[model samples]
Target: MNDLLQTYTFLNQAMQSDSLLCLAQAVCWLDPLWRGYDEDFYHDPDGILSAALVVTRQLFPDLYVDAIDKLRQGATYATVDQLICEGISNTGIPLDNLEYLPYGIPLPAYGVELNDADFYTTHPEVIPILACFGISPEANPYHMTIPDCVYTAAEIIATDLAKRPEEQYQQVAWGLLWLTSATNNSICDWDAELMMEVEPLAWETNDLAFARVMIEEADEIMGDVLTGLYWLTSEPAVMQAMQDNIHRIYKAIQKKGKNNDAPNIRLKWVDLAICPE
Candidate 1:
């Protein structure tokens, strides 16, 4: 981090709070907020910082703004007291230096790709996390390799979907699968099993009222996701097949129910449905 900031020149200066320090303090804030939002923390510097800026600005605008000004002017203190001092007492982050590493989220251990103009145009949400981590992306594989970053990206999908009104369920579910072409493996990757709920097949037909048939059939359409044939996030045929199958299933469920609103019945929870390990 010191090496990276040294390269930035301005960011490295001693405002003792805003630029480097403020970002450091942001880790303390951001580390928990993601979980509160959806319990998924991606740990990408760009996303985390972006979120931190939103949160800190709202919570402590005066102190945060002051820190930014100081960092801009390269302000410094003579005493160099512990972080528990008045500079950032409200956050209750314990330390003298920004060397703490146990937040589970990390500074970019690998090198960062500086100043990606495309990042804003392509993934503006990421600009903030990278800035907080004191870096940016546009390199290969990218922050997706980082476990926390991976988790964050996946969670942002369902991301507190449960918090939303049940009305948007059908549309969000269909649109997401249409764009993403997720399979059982993808669900495991995203733990989207949590997001998913299979309506009990209305008992009108000879089939079990379980979603096992629908998921299995849809997964078959996805064609061997386990062997990596269609393993990536988005496959055109794969996603479309899933979307089509979902429509079929919903129609079937509605027909069985003999009503427009199929009950949101889940025969078995995902963990229970999984074969005993």
Candidate 2:
């Protein structure tokens, strides 16, 4: 089996026994929070970060475990809050510095195309697992369905914030997006109804402080994500565009800050994408 499938199988077995919860909790506690309402984190960033953490520890335990321990020693809701403030406070780091080796989610060969059935047939065990979440796997070879199993497995090890009902729904929504991104070779129509659960939870929450912490922690933990997803946070234009979605939560619901973060993030993007390599 490919290393990616091997790791997934291991995690799958572990989840079946519910033995991985502690480790999942440990990562959630130590790493940044992915807010449910925030599409950037829940939809793509959180899953990327979680997959990076899970894979890094699985592949290089000493390096990742030690990092987690150290981060935990100093981690808190407040420290992470500061990190996001720092991210927003300054132009922030370049996207390249944030990039990491891409993780396993099989892609099609160059110039080749794959449909949903291709993924399901290749991984026969995935269909039923995903069905548990009401996300059916029925697309064709031209349209690959993201087996719900992946999201279900991911949620098993998701950040603590995902435990919140609103956040949990958002994470699921994000999980949908994450799967599509990983399968970049194919296109899937994302479910828009999922946002209904996310917006209200993100906006109605009594905990802006928690949301702030999730953002900051997401900033720090993702700074070194093994998956190349740091681009979501590092590239100014792309990151800003996504972050703008977060601020939209602010506008559509809270109507607070002036979305100053977007332009500043854009400046950071140019520096990363155009400046010296």
RMSD of each: 23.5, 27.4
**Clashes per prediction?**
13, 10
Best-fitting candidate, scored by TM-score: 2
Q: 189-248, model 1: which lDDT tens digit per residue?
A: 232232333222221222322333444444443333222222222233433433343344
lDDT of 1: 0.34
**For candidate 1, what is the TM-score?**
0.18
lDDT of 2 by residue, 1-277 (tens): 8999999999877766784786776556555433222325333353443443443444434444544554457564334334332332232211121122232221112111123455556645434433433345464345554443333333332332234344323333343334433322221222223322233212112333443444454443323231333323333453343334334333333332443231211111123334422
Cα error of candidate 1 at position 38, Å: 40
Model 2 scores a C-alpha lDDT of: 0.36
Worst 10 residues of 1 by lDDT: 104-113
